[model samples]
Target: MEYSFGPLIDENSKILILGSLPGVRSLAEARYYAHPQNKFWKIIYGAWGKTPDADFDARYRFILGHGLALWDVVKCAEREGSADGSIRNETPNDIPALLAAHPNIRRIIFNGGFAFAKYKKYFGAPAIDYRKVLSTSPACAGRDREREEMWMEALGRSL
Candidate 1:
């Protein structure tokens, strides 16, 4: 089983971003979006009007300070390599428990199609509104600029 890291969240978080699962590089590095080509950080930092920090701790602090939280939809899944398409026998994260703990969270954003699908299958639709962005993984084919636009539109000044 491939296990996911604990959520980067706090009681004040107003938005939660969910991924299907961490890629192999991220898991190996014990950091989200660790793959050099992933646009997750770039989009977030850009939307926040800042440059992306190379330091993981600084990035973590930035996320929390901005009232944004990050986690995966899957707690564990059987898969090979880092591709979301390979995931199988997945177990979803305890999202309802998380919502209970952080009642301030008002929006949920799925970072990719896979995350949205898995969330719908396992958790159904949340009472809160949600948005889906194109995957930021290098494996995803969309243009980075368009993805950034979508992210910016969804997150706006909330980040």
Candidate 2:
């Protein structure tokens, strides 16, 4: 299947953001952080004191300004819908491909716990250095705005 949103990557990217899969809004809009309420945009903007408006282009620019790259773990996955539980056996893209392609990547920040849990095998004990694996952002489930802001600050420092 053709990807709705191509990865917004560059050779200068120092931080990689990974998610389990894109949600409906993301797929429909062909952009990452399409869900306005997802807080991904707000968190990133807040870290840099940018206003989180409804404009998608502006948001993407803000992210790119910070040298952040975005992508999902499962590039081609079968899901009844956007629900993570509906995901089935799927083939993920070659993450090492990204790693190799972007030699400047110094940190890998999983957006949520799900992606971390799913890709831990390849990332957990692998020979690849884990020092670049930053903490899971608090924008994910159970974490509130305050926590998310804290994570964003930490992430900014790493980037």
Best by TM-score: 1
Runs off by more than 4 Å, candidate 2: 1-4, 122-142
Per-model TM values vs. the true structure: 0.96, 0.80
lDDT of 2 by residue, 1-159 (tens): 323245778876787777777777778887786776676776777777767867777777767778988887777777776666667776666788878888888777766556766676555532343222322333345656545665565476775
Candidate 1 lDDT score at position 66: 90
Worst 10 residues of 2 by lDDT: 129-138
Q: How close is each model in CA RMSD to the real structure?
A: 1.1, 3.5
After the best TM-score superposition of candidate 1, give how far the Cα of residue 107 lies from its true spot, in angstroms.
0.3
lDDT of each: 0.91, 0.66
lDDT of 2: 0.66
